[model samples]
Target chain A: MLAKRIIPCLDIKNGRTVKGINFENIRDAGDPIELASFYASQGADELVFLDIIATFENRKTLANLVKKVAHEINIPFIVGGGISSIEDVSILLNAGADKISINSYAVRNPIQIEKLAGFFGSQCIVVAIDTKYIDDDWFVYLNGGRIRLPLKAFDWAKQAESAGAGEILLTSMNHDGTKKGFAMDITMQLSKNLSIPVIASGGGGCMKDFLDVFEKAEADAALAASIFHYKEIEIPALKKYLNENNVETRL
Target chain B: MKVVIIKYNSGNVCSLANALERLGIRPILSDEPDELISADKVIFPGVGEAGNAMKYLKEKGLHLIIPELKQDVLGICLGMQLMCAHSEEGNTDCLNIFPLYVKKFVINKEDKYKIPHVGWNNIVLNNEVNSKLYLNTENNKYVYFVHSYYVEKGIFTSSETTYIIPFSASLKKDNFYAVQYHPEKSGKTGETILRNFINL
Candidate 1:
């Protein structure tokens, strides 16, 4: 049985963890590597480092960070944010990132998804969709959810799957930051329809929220940030909770 | 001890080297037959299409040297599949070190299973396995796996993991050992597995 993944996302800016971490018994709270090691020790299934610093000059910094994280952490991790070209992905993967995700770039030139997946096997390419429910339909958003596109989330995701995406990181703009729960309806719809694994991101408030997403939505993984960073919920305890609930989790 | 990881066109060799480094072993990345043949242990790591990987191996003449190496050799993911007799992926013929065939997963009408089984999955150690790879490790402990094709259970089977059906989690034959999961990315249990292989 494939265990449900519990991922803690770290937002990186200028090579430092932007979201302030509140974990104890550690040094250098802003150090991404330190936080990543802590999470891995706490039984995090995987980690995602989204380089929020979207500038060409900071590319070297992100690459160096990836190299450091890969050396210190044994678990697989994904690096994303501002990854547009094949050269960018080449730099990250060469720097030892296990996988990389692309967002607006994938929507801008969807062919790039095919080319990227073809160039580097689909197993390493993840298409992240930032979607929002608008006017009785879900539409894809871009530029960190600042710009709205006329594309339907389901249609774009289906197209992405056909274009060779190994997984989908679906984030509901409406449900995000609400701390209510994951967007169950849309997530379930996509997870049921798509053949690839769907990772439900955004509003992960409590442990039950995680269970709801996995059980109701059939999500392969659940990604959260603030709740973990602020010490609101610990990973090991959450896994234990889910295990008691009969959800298959890696402990 | 000298450890050499075969360097072909495949990816993840750098990560593998880092894992070995974590185990306090500095491995030599080389494609030359002499280095691979002379190393104390050979680690064949791969992540790519089987056809292209086979083509690169043949081009460098590693196809001949790898199978004949007498020392313990470990194959991972694509490397494991390539060590088998054949692969449905790319319809490519492998090195046949193990008399097994790699086949693509087929999920019956349920349509819930995902291809390229990603993330952590537990492995059930084969009964009375002699490899010592799973020594001191409890059964059903999870390891990281990311692949679409799997080797069928056979005489060389040492461990098994079930996704939709039972398939080879790890295979062993004489000096050749192969695992479908990524020990390099499997955290502590993975580190233990690698350490066991090094000890062997």
Candidate 2:
């Protein structure tokens, strides 16, 4: 059986980690490479680097940072935020990113997904869906959850899959940064409906939350940013907790 | 030792190069037949459609040269699939090095297995005498895999893993080694396997 993945997401701004990852060993938490290496040492299954403010010039810097992180870590690395075109994906993949996740651009131009999947096999294309529950239905949001679209979350997930997306990174806007728990109902729905792997992101507070998402939500992977960034939950200990709970996490 | 990674228009070559660099080996990425034949070890790494990749290989005449090389050759992911006799992906004909057919993974409605089995999965070694790929490694150690098509277990299968069914995780024959999983992305256990390959 494939082991459940524990991912540590780092928010990057201007080529540096934005959140101050409070780890005793890490002298500079703002350094992306330092935090990435720390996570790798702690047995993180994968890492996601989200460029919060991905300007044109900042994208170049993020590429360089990605190259550095790729050299420093051996695990799978995913880069997201402001990936708009094939050239952007090419630059990052050539710079050594294992996968590239797209959100707003994909929502606007769904055909780009199939084109990207054709150019760079579907294995590396991850479609990140930012959704918020509203009006008795889950709606997809764009531009970092500041704008809401008329598209339904579940419908968009299915469309992305058919558009050749290999995986879906589902983030619940309500649960994001709340540290409450993953969006179990929607995550479970997406995972069951899609044949591709679903990565449940947003709202991971405790180790039990990881287990709950995996066991109840049936998420193939659980992604958390602040909890891991702030050192609220250590990855190794969390994996240990999941393993003990029969979640089959990588230890 | 001179290590040469067969260069094709495939993905993940950079990552594989970085991985070799991590092991303190500067590998040459080349498709030149002479360079491949002269290298101490050759690695055929790929991540693309088999038909497209095969077209590129044939265009470079690598299709004719890869099978004839006498030195140790390692094929990864799509490289492994291409080393087989045939593949269901894109209906492409492979190098026939392993004399096996690569089939697409099909999950039944009742089964929960996902296609493109992308995650860390354990391998069950076939206990072959020449199988040094798992040297100093314990059983059930997880390795990273990302593929939609897989080669069925055969005489050359060195290790097996099951997603929906048992499939060749690693295949080995005279002077050729292939793994469906990405050792470069599998962390420590994967590094150990790559290190063992270098030592071999």
Candidate 3:
């Protein structure tokens, strides 16, 4: 059986790990590579490092950090935030990043999804959609959930799938820092509609939230930041709890 | 001991080198048949399309050199798929070292299983098989995998994993070994498997 994945997303700013509050006010968490190694050692199914600082000066820092992470951590880790073209992806993958996730660039130029998928199989390309509920519909947001687009979340996700994105990292902006739970209704609908894996992000609080996301929403993976980073919810304990609840977590 | 990683245009086989480096073994990444043939162990690692990988392997004549090498050769992910008879992906013919057909996972609307099984999944080691690849590795240990197609369980299957259907997670035929999962990225369980392969 394919186990439901528990991912610890480390938002990176200048090679350091930071956790954002609803994608805005951020504070330092730790070193990205050390946190990545800790998560991998603690039985994290996978790790995602979003380079929140996508500046020209930070590109080399991100790449150099990726090489160090690849050298140390044995588990698969994804690098995202500022990836736009094939050349950018080539540099990261060659540095030993397992997969690369894209958001703002992908939404602006959707055709790049197909081109990246064509060049480096769809399995390596992940499209991250930041969504917020407004006016009775979930709207897609870019620039770390600051800029909202006119696109509907569900429709855009379907389009991304058709364009050859291997996975969808759906983050609910409204429930991001609430620490209540994931937006189960939208997540369930998208999970049923898309053939690719949907990683429910942004609103996980406790072990039950993860259980709810997997058992109720049927998301293939669940990603959270502060909850795991701050030691509020330990990964091994969470997985053990999820497994005892019959959620099929890898323990 | 010369450990050569059979390199082609596959995506991110350098991760394999880093994994071996953690085990204190530096591997030679090369496409030369002479290097692959003379190495004590060869790792055929890949993460890309079957047809494209096979095309590159054949163009470099590695398709011919790999099977003839008498040393132990291990294949990972697409490398394992290319060792099979055929793949539904791009309708490409593989090296046929395992004689099993590789087919894409059909998206069953009723099951709703994801197309690419992209996570950590456990594998049940076949106790009957004498492959030392899982020597220190425990049965039902989780390993990372990211592929849409799978090789059917056959006489050469050394370990099995069930998703939508039962399939060979690892296969062995004399001097050749292949695993559909990424031991290089499978954390400690994967480290054990890689160590076992290196010690072989």
- Alpha-carbon RMSD of each model: 2.9, 2.8, 1.1
The candidate maximizing lDDT is 3
Query: What is the DockQ for all candidates, taken in turn?
Result: 0.81, 0.83, 0.87
TM-score of chain A of 3: 0.98
Which residue runs does candidate 1 get wrong by more than 4 Å? A20-29
Mark the 10 consecutive residues where model 3 chain A has the least summed lDDT: A52-61
| Candidate 1 local lDDT, A130-238, one digit each (tens) | 8999999999998877789989999999999999998999989887766899999989999999999999988889999999999999999999887887789999999
Candidate 1 to truth, TM: 0.97
- Candidate 2: tens digits of C-alpha lDDT, residues A131-242: 9999998999987777899999999999999999999999998888778899999999998888999999888889888899999989999998778877889988899888
Winner of 2 and 3 under TM-score: 3
Taken in order, the candidates have interface RMSDs of: 0.9, 0.8, 0.9
User: What share of the reference contacts survives in each candidate?
Assistant: 0.76, 0.74, 0.94
Model 3 stretches with alpha carbons more than 4 Å out: none
Among residues 3 or more apart in sequence or in different chains, the pairs in candidate 3 whose N, CA or C atoms overlap within 3 Å are none
List model 1 lDDT by residue over B99-199, tens digit each.
89999999866768989899999999987556788887888999999999999999888999998889999999889999999999998999999999999
Question: How far out, in Å, is residue A223 in model 2?
Answer: 0.2
Highest TM-score scorer: 3
How does residue A209 of candidate 3 score in lDDT? 93
